[model samples]
Target chain A: DAGVTQSPTHLIKTRGQQVTLRCSPKSGHDTVSWYQQALGQGPQFIFQYYEEEERQRGNFPDRFSGHQFPNYSSELNVNALLLGDSALYLCASSQTGTGLYNEQFFGPGTRLTVL
Target chain B: DQQVKQNSPSLSVQEGRISILNCDYTNSMFDYFLWYKKYPAEGPTFLISISSIKDKNEDGRFTVFLNKSAKHLSLHIVPSQPGDSAVYFCAASGAWGTDSWGKLQFGAGTQVVVTP
Candidate 1:
């Protein structure tokens, strides 16, 4: 089975500009989560989506938003991007939302560069 | 504030030897711990996990030991190979119920290099 997949392997945007990143969940998975990994740091949770609604979000500001489609694909939109927004955006998928034991499968990630 | 911390930024070990990476957390509420390995330009892959109920968990050549009292956990790799060299991240989550929502908090990560 195919694992999680993300689109726009890399991107470049200027300050104040917006960018949209996409992700396809792994086969047989329904929950999708987005993370931002800054250089020399581990991935930080952005938000999580389940059943087409956002379930949990991290400390990120309102500039960062996400959507989950009926097909279980997800889109992460960053408005008014800042220089700090330049990082690797990773998408992870899990089989269930309620189980604490479920392991998440990650995608290759989309690298975003803000100028 | 960094809830999870990997004090060692990097480590080098000779092939066929044992490699141990350590992690500490300040959040006592974190009960589930996990280790993830990542190569350059790739997302982290799950290595092993241990629940608060158990002090240790082993799978193949990898093992994770959790010391809840000390808020510390470690990943041990035996007979390390060059391919085992990668960045490792420690993650923790509270119980699924309540306000936790199963969110995972991650450490900065440690780079491990196994040389022949």
Candidate 2:
């Protein structure tokens, strides 16, 4: 089976521009979560979506938002992007009821470069 | 604040030997810990994990040891292979059934290089 997939392997945008990145969860998974991995650092949680509603979020600004469609695909949108917004955006998927012990499968990640 | 910390930025190990990667955390609330391996340009792949209630868990050539009292954990790879050379990340989460919902707190990753 195909694992998690993300769109736009790479992106480039200037400050104040809006960018949207997409992700498709692994087959048989119902939850989608987003994370940001800065260079030389581990990924930090951005937010998670279940049942098309945002269930939990991390310490991110309001400019960062996301949406989960009926098919469990997700889109992360960053508005008024800043130079620091550049990072590797990763999308992970897991079953809704698997809880914390279950493994989270990740996508290849989209490289966002803000100029 | 970084609740989880991986002090070593990089480690080199000879192939066919044991490779140990350590992680420490300050958050006592964290009850579940995990390790992930990532290659350049790719997202992290789940390696192994251990719960707070358990002291150790092993899978094939990989094993994880957790010390609850010290809030520390370690990943041991036996017969380390060249393909095992990658960035290893340590992550933790609060107890299940809480609002955490798999939102993991990760440490600065440690890069492992295995040479033949």
Best by DockQ: 2
What is the C-alpha lDDT profile of model 1 across A1-115, one tens digit per residue?
Answer: 8989999999999999999999999998999999999999988989989999998889999999999999999999999999999999999999884466657778999999998
For each of the candidates, the C-alpha root-mean-square deviation to the true structure, in angstroms, is: 1.1, 1.0
Cα RMSD, model 1: 1.1
Q: Report, in order, each candidate's fnat.
A: 0.68, 0.77
In model 2, which residue pairs have backbone atoms overlapping below 3 Å?
Answer: none
lDDT of 2 by residue, B19-45 (tens): 999999998888889999999988899
True contacts kept of 2: 0.77
lDDT winner: 2
Q: Write the per-residue lDDT of candidate 2 for residues A17-83, one digit (tens) a residue.
A: 9999999999999999999999989999999999999988999999999999999999999999999
lDDT per residue, candidate 1, B1-116, as tens digits? 89999999999999999999999999888878999999998888989999999999999999999999999999999989999999999998777764445577899999999999
- The per-prediction tally of clashing pairs is 0, 0
Native-vs-model 2 lDDT? 0.93
